[model samples]
Target: MITIAVDAMGGDYGPQITISGALKCLEMVPDLRLILVGDQEQILPLIPHNLSSFVEVVHTDQWVAMDDKPSKALRGLPNSSMKLAAQCVAEGKADALVSAGNTGALMAISRHVLQTLPGIDRPAIMARLPVREGATYMLDLGANVDCQAEHLYQFAVMGTAFAAANGHVVQPKVALLNVGVESIKGNQQVRLASHQIAQCDALNFIGFVEGNELFSGKADVIVCDGFVGNVALKASESVMRLAVDKIQKRLSVWWLKWLGLFLKPILKGLARELDPTYLNGALLVGLNGIVVKSHGASDEQGFSNAIMQAYREVSNKSNDHFEAIMDQIEF
Candidate 1:
């Protein structure tokens, strides 16, 4: 059974959404076991008595608040739910961890507790975004604001390995997120990183990509600093919502209403593809342990999706698998 540690008191709904989602995931994956870390008083009552065999609860007195600063959580609360969940992985009690907690706190405590993988200076948040070719892996989604060219190289290598391991792509094209495809378009950092990546035989670096090509499937791995990546991610999501609303309103017309009904299956497929909850986990890649971050406001479907992601990573020993590939690349 794949063991997954879950911060049950992390998200907005805490035990309500997380514990429910854990139970739902257990029902889906019979070989999966979960360690739900939270306050006993808040979590125990929610779990069904019969599930005590598969689902274990670890009680902690503190929880990292949604607004708690990373430094404060790291310095003040050593035994928070988030910390204990991460500790399970550090101590080998759990194979992977999932949390819908304070993103900064999760990152900070995870780094402090688990440390970074060999030769990695920092961790980057990588998420699979829907694209023409199914999905593209984008990294540094609000993890590191200020990054060096070497950091981008690490993201490139790790992102490439991730695409191959999970996305089932061979020689996944890696690109530097820049103003244009030309080397002259971006700032010094991107241009320098591009040249270095091109020199590294381990990574399949494909020069630069513009923001517009983000979802065009031009590159399987898109590398950028957290500021640009976070903004672009949010903007694309906003645009997706706007486009969906407009399409729905347009289809509601008297003549098109029947056509829309006839294409309901196709529409539902599109909705699933675009649904954020369907692909809710973000990898804290470069950390020593496998850590997945669920959206703080995620519901059962989304939180469970995150847990499933942890399960897959644990089942495949993805972190160790990727590390083998990473060993080939020199940053």
Candidate 2:
């Protein structure tokens, strides 16, 4: 059985949604075990007595708020639920750590507690975004806001490794997110990154991808610094929500209303498919163990999927493969 440590107190819904998600996941995967790391008093009551045997609670009074600075919180409260969860993974008690907390806090704790894989300078957060052609895995989603050229190159390598392990085609085409497709269109950093990515042997480094080509199904892995990646992710999410909302509102008139009723289930399915909450979680790549970061507002489904992603990472031994690849890199 693979054990996953979940930060029960991290999200807006607290243990209720977190525990509910775990229960749903348990129903789906029989071999999964969960360590609910939070205030035991709050979490234990939310879980069913029957499931008490399968789910273990790690008591911790400290909670990291959404606004808390990652470094200070991790240093001041060594036993914060998030910190403990990462520690559990580091100590071999849990195979992975999943949290719907502050992204900075998760990255900080993972780095301080779990440590990075050898040859990895810093960890990057990545997510698989649904595109018109197929899903594309994007890296540095928000881990390192200010990154160097070498860091972007490492993100490409990590994103490639993740895509391959998660079933993307061999030697997935990797592209650097840029203002334009032209090689000379971007800033100094992007130009440097472009050169470095082209030189890397481990990745099938494609050239720049302009904002317009993001959803064009041209690349399998998109690499960028966290600032650009985060902005792009947020913009995409807002656009999706606005579009869905408008469609639903427009469908609420006369005969169109009946179509809305008939398409309700389909709409719900589509919403679920495109929901940012569904993709709220991100993988902390370059770590020795699997650690996923979820949105602070994530609900049960988001948390559950995060757990499933962790399971996939552990089962695939992505970290081990990534480390091996890094060792083979010339730099």
Candidates in order: C-alpha RMSD to true structure: 1.9, 1.7
Structural similarity to truth (TM-score) of each candidate: 0.94, 0.94
For candidate 2, what is the total of clashing residue pairs?
A: 0
In candidate 2, what are the lDDT values of residues 23-96, reduced to their tens digit? 77888888889999999898877887777778989999998888899877789788899999999999999999
Regions more than 4 Å wrong, model 1: 258-272, 275-278
Model 1 lDDT, residue 60, Cα: 93
Q: Tell me the tens digit of each residue's lDDT in model 1 across 1-331.
A: 7899999989888889999988899889999999999999988888888788998899998998899999999989988999999999999999998999988899899999999988888899988878886678899888898888988988898898888877477788999999988768888888888988899887888889999998898899999998899888877766766766677788899989887677666755665556443466788999888999988888898899999888988788788778887776676
Model 1 pairs whose backbones collide: none
Q: What C-alpha lDDT values do all the predictions have?
A: 0.86, 0.83
- Lowest summed lDDT over 10 consecutive residues: which window, candidate 1? 271-280
Looking at model 1, how many pairs of residues clash? 0
Question: In angstroms, how far off is 41's CA in candidate 1?
Answer: 1.2
